[model samples]
Target: MLTLYHNDMSVCSQKVRLCLAEKALAHEAKHLNLRAGDQQKPEYLTLNPKGVVPTLVDDDVVVTESVVINEYLDDAYPKHPLKPVDPAERAKMRWWTKQIDDSIFPATGTVSMSVAFHHQYTPEVLDELTRQRGPGYRARFALLQKGTDNPNFSDAIKRLYKMINDMNVALERGPWLTGEMFTLADIAYAPYITRLDHLKFLGFLDKNPRTAAWYERMRSRETYRAALAAQFNPKYLPLMEEKGREAWPRVKALVGLA
Candidate 1:
């Protein structure tokens, strides 16, 4: 039996869940409460060493990293393939997914924290949250505390803008990120786009109509409903929506939309 250790609303976890849903695979779920620091506990650290969510176990075989896990799933279950059959298109898919790990994912976290999630903490809670992190995460904690004033915020906005602009250009060629196939590339980006939607930071999409349309097509998929929408955390929504909307003017200005 396949077992997945994941958090309900984590983007990485959502990516894995989308892959499983796309492939129609059956698996057991172990939910982690990230704010509660469940992922940092010794047991989970043993499984993922990095103390992150969406760790997949196929029988005794363990897999970490969302992109790697998705590729592993496609390779392990060939019935409903998520990767393109063409080599060039497959390479394109990898390129999109690679950018996520290299920059987009980190930017999402920065933007999300700067615009919304930082508001979720009180002074005491923030202290506890910061104390929970290891040395490497101190910079991120600083971003969370400083919000959009962080020096990195503008760069994060630029990265996300580049993502949307690039998506619009690529999508003009075909319906999905990697041309005709709704491959792992599409699955990989779904959550990040949804993050912009949730945070109301979609002003970047205003000029990128094709990327907007592509996002709508993605949202229309059953896998999106099953994997992402169904997993929405109620507690986080109000804060994300409220703070996200309030931050839009600044975010829009940062993206040069203003």
Candidate 2:
């Protein structure tokens, strides 16, 4: 039996769901409400020590981390291969995902927090999140406290813009990041692109036709609707927009469009 503990809007969770959906794998879904402190509960912490979303339990085996879980699904299932058969291409896949973690992930978190999330967080919520040991979450708490006046905001936007440009350069190799075949590399970056779009960072897309094309193709995939778009939480739309629009000008100027 396969069971997954995940949150609706978590990009990591959506990656797992995308892999599962692509493989036509059936799994029990235990949707956790991260906002309600569900991930912090002792029971969940036992499963995922980091108190994060998208834990996959396959019979007696458990998997944490979205990238790890997606790889696990491909390895365990093997019917629908998400990894490249060639060693070089597989290595490229890992590099793509790693670049996202090292570059895109941090900026996306800061942008999301500096805009929408910081507005919603109270001192108590910030304190609770602040107490969490996860580096990214703790970093988010710090950014949240910075409010919209973050000095690091411009740098973060530039970093993401650079990453997007690099992605476009990578895609110039072929239709997909890993050539003609779509693999975990595409899945890894797609959700981040979606989040950027939501934050009105479409400006990044305009300059990178290849990345823009790849993202459009991703949207047309069935797994995208089931995995990414379906899980989008519209509840945050109002704040994401209000703050996103307010922040876009500064972001634009940083990227030299303004």
Candidate 3:
């Protein structure tokens, strides 16, 4: 049996869930409350030393990391392949995935977390943000820092702008990131792109028409929809449902899904 240890609001977790949906595979899902630190519990830590969400336990083997989990599913379940058959094509797919992770994911995470934490939490993370004084917030901003000397927010936005431009260029090539066929690269990127749209970072799309069209394609897929419904935050559910028609089709098409 396949079992997924996930958190509803985690983009990485949503990636794995979407992979399962694409494969038309049935799996057990265990939702971890990240704010509650359930992923850090000893039992969960035994499954993933890093204590991260979206850990996939397939029989006895455990897999951590979203891209790894997605690849594993494609390899282990042959029904619907999310990777390219050609080796060179596969390499290109993997390259785009890595690029999206390095450039897109962290920026979206930092900005969204900043907004959400400010709005949702009782005691704002702003207290944490404030201790940084003028520039350096000392509360071990390590997790979201992404190996940069610049302050976290500055670093995140820099990477984000680069990623948005890169995505726009790729979309001009049409349909999916790895060209006409949908591949792992698209799957890896769709969730984060969907997230930016959710945060009304839609300006990123408006600035790049190709990206806007590409995103509309990605949003129309059953896999993307399933993942969105299954993994989006309940707090964001109403918002997501309301705006989903606008966001998901583009993302689904981006992943080469209907």
Candidate 4:
């Protein structure tokens, strides 16, 4: 009875898909072709003003934003509850979820965006594309220059490190980020962090064995595995594979793909 608007490869959408799958809830999936700008169409825009993927329509109620959707699903189902009863533990889950989103998501986006732009257009053409797209997009487009921008790269790297260290500390608190039990927090963080690790931009965990172990544990879950196996542009695969070629062995070893 739920209709989910999602792109198979989107980390945000994967979050929702993982939650729904874990709950064994059957839902209709309408895959948005983001590359074709389907999300910007009038019909889809009526469902989500922001025109983002992973929009969930439950009966008459509509929910956008992956994190919010995760909470909504957990609250709605309440059978196999993802959030624990303890207020403190729930608070910790929310906190870590925010940390994961704010930190890992952006850095990975920057890296991926950089690669995408380069693959799609020449520098001169890209410059024209940015000009036509406007400042908001231009700023994102400029993420390609992160290496030259010390402040930018430093901030990204610092946030990535903090995300790893924070999770490591959370592990010290207990098995899961919130404490003993696994919850929505793990589901939220797994896709983005695993994608980054798969890309080998995970120096944060490289030196921290605790976080490395935690990374391994998170990827072992069926939900996480299912999410990673979602579809994407086959062309992008070889590029991601080639770009992260050096990381292949380590990534495979970590995820048991080896």
C-alpha local distance difference test of each model: 0.89, 0.84, 0.70, 0.71
Compared with the true structure, what per-residue lDDT tens digits does model 4 show for residues 18-101? Answer: 889778788999998765567878899899988778899999999998889999999999888999799988998898778656
Residue-by-residue lDDT tens digits, candidate 3, 1-258: 999999877888887887888888999999997755677678999999887888999999999988888988999988878888888888888888787566677676665544333334333443534432333553434433332232565556556656767878987776888788887777777777777666555655656777778777878887888876545676875554444344344433442333
Clashing pairs in 1: none
lDDT for predicted candidate 3 compared with the true structure: 0.70
List candidate 4 stretches off by more than 4 Å.
Answer: 115-118, 121-136, 139-151, 230-233, 244-258
The best candidate by TM-score is 1
The sequence of per-residue lDDT tens digits that candidate 1 reaches over residues 101-213 is: 99999999888988887776666765665677655565667766777787899999899999999999999779999888789999999999999989988888899999999
Instruction: Return the candidate ranking by lDDT, descending.
Output: 1, 2, 4, 3
Winner on lDDT (1 vs 3): 1
lDDT of 4: 0.71
Error of 1 at 19 (Å): 0.6
TM-score of each: 0.95, 0.93, 0.79, 0.82
- Candidate 2 lDDT at 118 equals 69
Checking candidate 2 for backbone clashes, the offending pairs are none
lDDT: worst 10-residue window of model 1 = 129-138
Best by lDDT: 1
| CA RMSD of all predictions | 1.6, 2.3, 7.5, 5.1
The local lDDT score (0 to 100) that residue 92 gets in candidate 1 is 92
